[model samples]
Target: MSLNPPDLRPDLAPKMRLDAPRPGQPTIGMVSLGCPKALVDSERILTRLRAEGYAISPDYGGADAVIVNTCGFLDSAKAESLDAIGEALTENGRVIVTGCLGAEPEYITGAHPRVLAVTGPHQYEQVLDAVHAAVPPSPDPFIDLLPASGVSLTPRHFSYLKISEGCNHRCKFCIIPDMRGRLVSRPAHAIVREAEKLVANGVRELLVISQDTSAYGADIRFAEERGHRAHIDDLARDLGQLGAWVRLHYVYPYPRVRNLIPLMAEGLVLPYLDIPFQHAHPDTLKRMARPSAQTETLAEIAAWREICPDITLRSTFIVGYPGETEAEFQYLLDWMDAAQLDRVGCFQYENVAGARSNDLPGHVPEEVKQERWERFMAKAQAISEAKLAAKVGTRQDVIVDDIDADGIATCRTKADAPEIDGNLFIDEGTEGLAVGDIVTVEVDEAGEYDLWGRLPA
Candidate 1:
């Protein structure tokens, strides 16, 4: 999980008197590592700090202390976390290592004695206590650590709103469950309240995220307990009422999720869905412990089209799993062509410890895996261009996100998620444009993936 620092409070007085040294306070810097979920957690931490009256410095050198939000989901992730720790140690400021990596911080503090604290999920409950004790307290009280139903991040015009936490999926290639635990959802009331807060803060586009968004409410079974049936679709419906463009990510294409397509067709939710299909070949998927039959998978996609004809499906595929045959790769390519999916991300399979796929037989060599990835991506690029070309002359409601000094404006349509998907680029000369304002734009040109357009007068 990657983390971003909390949005500073506009109300902070900038100057403050000193309190008795409580621990780690006065000046603060945060480095969040991993995915967007982790980023949200760090944002919450920042919200607490801002409430307490601390000045947040973007640079570590300027702060009295720094916090590193670490990721340990995979070998590469662990290595990156270690590198972050090394960099933190060299700085003169006191350091605190937190997050999933804090699940095991002996690797860090064992080498760096200057580290002030090593904390994990359990430890985080007392974040202010630990930080305050680390340094002398200033006039600012520590920020509230209580869960907030509000956003305190930057006014980026768009933000990722994580509705649930952790994963219940046991895909052998994944370590998410080990790192984040089983599915636990924040209550629907909390989620809706947070959405309102975000919209009030000028976030016009919301990306709903979780390890498996479809599984929301399953563990709680709020549907059964309250004698009222509620599902992810219901959650989406409630969030949609907040009057913002809502989108979903990491949705496993389960039958239950198919039920939400109709909900999405109603126009408040974007027609876009990001489901990680992993691989199209049944045997490869089984080895990864995804356990879905090939026919069932295709049927779900077919159902999506039947429910929402204009649906823009985005998916990720893994190439060269253990025991993958050339024929299996061919089947994947053929499926892509047949499906003609709108947006696709393909990654060469990387082996991670504790994943069942690593123990499976017939692993493909590095060179062959790289070749397959290249071939599939080349085909996907052409498919993307053709799809974009089909949109020329069509108008889309794009929320203005940023305006460059050169006078060009960058924005996103309902079909596009922030940062990962394509964007609508408008000429700088557009009048009365501001970030967070929605405007209609007609596609005048297209490239391989992006749509070029002009704002309506």
Candidate 2:
């Protein structure tokens, strides 16, 4: 087990599986980069393409054209996106670029002018048009039919449900608002309809994601449509009744978020919240132009626990932000000690192109940033170890993610989110355990980031 777990990379996309193309089928390869939000965009694009008779190619050699879904969240991510574009161009000469990076077409084209076209985030029509221009879709009416649930980059057991597009927050360190524009929520009935189809298609977990989940119907005024309200709490209640695990992510700790806790307590949704608490120090938050309510947040956490003791709080933080003093960093460390968050991810701040934080004064030196990151992770690892040790004697309902040929099963508890959180391993007595099966196991062993358990006799 890893003692000091690595910081979660929001840029990582889930592994995708594609079927082999039939004879003379138009095929497209996708290099989907960035977070689950972008992955959802890729899924939508591919679903549209599939409906138009395009087969998804797992590799460049098999594809007639390649689509590079880019991430421009950070400078490093921009570089990565450029590299992916270059690689796709090398492998498949026809390339279409889209995503956050595509918002700045010049930025993408400057490095790779050979790309056929570039479209911004969630521009399905533009992407489809680009694909059609590059690769004429030859849909055989009998073979080219869209699946009910659409093309999903995630496994069939779980899917990322994007509730809205863009964010209204102007956090100095973030450029998302500039790239993706403002919050635009889909209709409440429409979102529920999509979730219903996904559930019917065998998706057991629905990870609700957006730039700001709490702010979900504020732009739409929580408009009600056909028995569903556009509010986050109301949306959660509707999704919970769909007989699937509903996990909320990217939730800003607005006062209204308290309403979701009781839903978790009632088993209407998973008792997990993925909040991005960038820093704990008020001064640091002020510098970042984020909410500086560290004290009130602690109170909120306490209140949430009071309502649902079993709730798993997962948060991401940033250390070494511009002008972050040693005292400020220590304040964050002390806050972590008090929070005792069930799952924690910490990032050493990096400047992104066009981000307001890049202009902020007193940027922390690289050495200081690295040192602070190490210290922050050590504290987090200790907390994780102790918290996990407490669960050693308890029982957890885990969803089987994989069952190996050797019969060892890799599973995740309700507290764990796929690709970002810990896992529970079942090394023996694993007969008949299949992927997507939710089974209860006795927790017998604990480590810093994983647990080992077995089927109860």
Candidate 3:
């Protein structure tokens, strides 16, 4: 699986020329928003900044410089990004903005007057250099030096590991095509090296992420560069060999994904897959500018489950896409009922400014959108509870995350994919555990979205 591409010159650290301030660094305040992919990008920049001797400040109040990594996936997200930029301007410090939102010329120019510069995923490495080489400069001593250890702003136990960047999908509701550009996957060997580094620093779980993970190897110049194709299955195989508990997220269930089911069944990778199938109705999908082969897509899912019987499939549905009829929404709900999905979430469609759907006719009203969203979630919550209840008598491996002040212990299982997913709650007892310790827990009770469990003595 270590198929190294011949053309990619591997450099563990590529040297970049940026002027450095003499003997001092400033405290950096970083705010990362959006999905796991954005988090991974933020992590890389933060790692580089810390390596360059910048002290990280928890709050923006006293920091000498501020960096805001933003999300531009939806209209609401764009508004929040603008709000963050305004807040960063109030700091009276050197400001930097990056991420999909920074790709917008109007947003960067209009909102962030105080920002010294703005960059996107294409210029992440360069942005770090800019932060270091600021003319006003960081006030601390040892400016040109790197930190002795990599600092993680997140909880120490787990981290979001991104495999690649950007998307190639042209779904009408999505603005990623306009914002993040096309899919550009990193070499598998490089990703493995990065994962090894993260593991050395205490990350136990690797969340394999991308906009469209199944399309991983398509952009990779495999024939001339590598002797093989750069695919998610190959990537998953490589990551599984790392011996960390690996998880896959944002995987689209295309026909090619069937090859990955066996890897999931092997237990090296978790029996979980995140597929964002927006809607099940074929006509609705076509109007949304998505793949219209409804039967084939469902057949692929059926085939995957046939091979990997234990797959914990999670997907998302959008209720209010333009031109979606009442019958179409009902069809999606009925499809959900038929699929018996283990985990599911529903989002009401939003008309993003740059997306094509904004101008589409037959837009669902706000009240109607809200009602559909509520109805779908109401059904989904029941299904989620039933699925968790089924596991009430089983023992699952969970990473212990905390012992809260109220004597409640919280953690997550391999089945849960952090942030947006469910958690495992254990009543505090004399067993005595600390964060990052993986233990076997017996589930005793189940709630709407979480499992109540106790660590084995």
Candidate 4:
């Protein structure tokens, strides 16, 4: 019965659930934090452990040791990661910390000196070494074979396909490039091969993710192998052929992105884009060292809509950044009104420890930042309400995500991404619908960020 909150923590990964461990298996628990990218890292580490005959425990009490995969994107996230590490340390007594926060080993050790070890993000071997030292793996070669799709932290229905690591952009508000380093894309064939295995293993959706999805192969010069190219457009086309829902995330608004619209229009991929247009004002964007082409972006949006009318545009924005004037904030509101983006998320800028924006002049007061956030969210909500209202009579194809005991089926349309966007709920006649089943429903009612639908006769 809950609608999508106005302030969704889109950066969070879906909660993890693991199968029971085999008898006498040395189990390790994982506390995955941060974005889906980090979640993928956790999955990789767990898969490697599983391959070596280690079991994944879902909780501290059941674990021999725990891995705290941390996020250090924002000050708040850092605090949360530290808190998670502390809790894991207390509950399990043995913890290995790895992730963006692990990049600052002294910071973690300063907070929790009891941690067994700390390894930076995606350092699988180091994490494994730490784990092997903490809890020796007992390989039951007859039973410890890894699954084809590996140890998925997410549900079997959908998987996050990280095409690349790190980012090249040095935005003032971000330290990702500093922490994760420059873009390093996976080979085209490797990604496609992974996707094929995921599909074969019952994954119905592929959430393509990266630090900057549009720049997937920039570092590799868009290399081609086995009939697949590392470029975003080519990759999307390749993934689309796998017969699963392909949703792209963290895409920058590059001119080349327009090429993907035709693929969406052709039903090759989901007609959805999750871009982060941090701010709309040119000055604000320039200060953030981001592209300040608001006018060009609006035109590109219009062009995209013309090509793929059903496309759902989802974007996140940062408000009240350093040097943001009230006029600049209002300009953003005006831009939102004109753009009429289908899905939106907003953040009130806060200084991360190493971000360049901290030294920028004219930092807005905390109260002003909160006030701007409220106003921005209000605008976004009103737009969302109207947009959902318009879909009241439309028939949408939704993938069932869950079915409650009361028989309410929670589903997401092509316009919706899992966990972040609005949902279409089927209140009755959900007897036959199971998780991952796609069905057509007639929208009967709508709220600010959700819809009530019924199975079509």
Candidate 5:
């Protein structure tokens, strides 16, 4: 029997199948960590397990075994993943660890040697095998069958659609390619069919994700349709017809990406781009093995804004990479000021063990990195505040995410993504409002990060 409990932890996977078991049937609990991409993997795993008649327990104590989908993107993330493993082991005793951190099984087994199994990212079959060995599924096809809605960790209104797997970029500081392997695009028809199913099942928004969305059709040679191949442009065109908000994420600023702008303008897709600029300085970008020509990119940004004035461009940058001089940091600041990007995220550099950046010269000291991070955040915050202040008078369409017991509703506009970006709060006129309702709100107040708006009486 399925027990649908609201997942309180935003960081945990949203689409979990918390099914209470039949007598003598094994139930598996999972603690999913890391980014939305990793969470998607967890969703896929749980979906497969559910199909195999393996019930999912919401808490570790009630489960026959637990799966910990981990993150190893940064040192901090790895530490958190390890802590989660310890927590699971302490609570349930039977734990299986997997994900990016699982790529290095020794690191995990060294800390928690009693874990049932450790497997790397995308090793869904191995994870199932481990689960079978620990808590085998006993299927009663008629009794244990799943719903047509499928297993999802996200809310019913939205879903993260991973169009491809892995990265082709060899950025010095990143090991995603190592952890998740090279680019592998799905067939166009397959993606569309999944998206169509999602929309048909009441998914109102689709967050398209991958290591590099711009590199989507490259691996598959773009042959997804009847000889048309699965290219992003075509994929966007096809998915746009599903009558849901299509938000593209992790798109590199490749030349081909420009082709997608017109779709946003034409109202086929949301006018939002979550690109990672990394660093603005040419020298720093070169050291990190990224595109260093900022001039053209800035020009392209201007051109994109011209094409779609309502477009919201979001980007992330690394502030204190190894060998990142003060001038380079200043260039980044200056670029931020000039670009006036709609949304921004900054990170101070952390040395991953196997990354080439660790071997580079002039690693910034920790104290300096921290100070630079403060300065970098200050600059971005000021820019964000100014940009948000400009939107105070405009009316925006907002999708309600949640409403509290006190009747206050929290919502997001097309420009605001689910978590990373800001939110819109509805204080008054929330009588008829409900989560997932799309309503018009007049921007009345703006803060450094969030906005306050209310519906018309």
Candidate 6:
């Protein structure tokens, strides 16, 4: 996840202050880490504080306290989260920690004993109480009036719309179910209302995220209302009418997900799927405890492509599993050749604490894991090059994201998601173009992982 580690710095939070202000008002600075789900949690926490008349500081220097949202998904992430907490202590002196890593409060306080308080993941009330004890807010309506539109931690042009919380999967290599608990989806109306507000606030794209997007409303049993069920397809179709690009993430390849292909085909949603197919070999998948992995995914992919010819399948894989063999790894590479997935991410398996995979037999050595990771990445890169090369001379609609120091505009096609997937670079003919504007670009250059293009005449 280092590719785009959770953006915890206060710089990512909303630039506008929702709190009006009072004399000697308390200001809180936040540092969020982990996945988009965790990011949403941090946003909610800050929004609550803002409503209570606490000002959000974009830097730690002026803030009375800081909240360090941590990620405990991987050992490496845990170490980084600890380092962030320590930094908060050194820089601000008054610090409270929350997030997945906060589940092990002792582990954190053991490292940063001076932290003011520690709370577990998504414990909004506990976090607020901790902040109150540390630095109480002094609301003066003269300065701080609570606004209906809450503070966001993402760029105003785009926002992450988290549909649900937690997961029910028992993948042996994962401890998410242990930390986040079972799936609990929000009602379709609430999701639509939030998307409506975001779009009204000038958000051009909404990236729908959750632990298991395909399982949305499963726990709700597809409760019906106003002729729409609470399922993802219903939620997605509802969100599509809000005049913004709706992209789905963290979707499992459940058979029922095929119903969404028509929505993509009809331009209601982006023709993209972000599936996490951890491994290809049945034995390795079985060892990982991802029973759904044994499904005929290739056939499913073919059917999806048949429905939406322009669909771009993006997936992540775990290489060097505990019991992975040369044959099993080769099987993954061969399957990649057959799948021709548009985008891919490869991670070397590591023993995350509390995950069942840690004690699994046949643990590959560090050197072996590193070697396999390099080979796996090389193959994925080659595939990316070929896939992108095929787009040369093709014009694609792109949403501008950034203009680099060199004045090149960074953008993404419908096939690309923010931060993780590749981008298209616009080096010329971008007169007066701004971020979030959708425009067509003719592909002029293709790198292994990115493309260069320009506005057409």
TM-score of each: 0.88, 0.97, 0.88, 0.98, 0.94, 0.94
**Preferred candidate (TM-score higher): 1 or 2:** 2
For candidate 4, write residues 1-457 as lDDT tens digits: 1111223456777878688787799999999988899999999999999999999998899999999999988888888888899898788899999999989999999999999999998999999999999999899999889887899988789999999998988899999988899889999899999999999999999999999999988898999988889899899999999999999999899998999999999999999999999888998899999943565899999999999998999999888799999999999999999999989987778888899999999999888988998899999999999999999899998888899999999999999887788888899998888898988999999999999999988
Model 1 regions lying over 4 Å from their true place: 1-25, 109-114, 121-123, 141-154, 223-230
Q: Which candidate, 2 or 5, has the higher TM-score?
A: 2
What order do candidates take by lDDT, descending?
4, 2, 5, 6, 3, 1
Candidate 6 wrong stretches, greater than 4 Å:
1-24, 226-228, 404-406
- The reply for model 2, stretches above 4 Å from the true place, is 1-11
Off by over 4 Å in 5: 1-25, 226-228
lDDT of 3 by residue, 1-457 (tens): 1111111111011111122333344667777767667766776776676665666666676567778887777777777777778887776466788888877856777766667788875477767767876623343344445533255545666766666677877888888877778888877767777777878777788878788888886787532233323667777887888777888888877777788889888876888888888789988988887843565676777888898887888887788889989999998888878787887866678877788888889988878988888788888888888889999989999987778887777888888877667799988672577888788999999999899987676
Ranked candidates, highest TM-score first: 4, 2, 5, 6, 3, 1
lDDT on C-alpha atoms for all candidate structures: 0.73, 0.90, 0.74, 0.90, 0.85, 0.84
lDDT (10s digit) by residue, model 2, range 112-225? 999999999999999999999988989989978888888888889999999999988889999999989999999989999999999999999999999999999999899999
User: Residue 57: error of model 1 in Å?
Assistant: 1.2
Error of 5 at 456 (Å): 1.9
Off by over 4 Å in 4: 1-8
**Which residue pairs collide in model 6, if any?**
8-31, 8-32, 20-143, 20-144, 21-143, 21-144
Q: What clash pairs does model 3 have?
A: 23-142, 23-143, 24-140, 24-143, 51-146
Q: After superposition, how far is residue 26 of candidate 4 from its true place, in Å?
A: 0.4
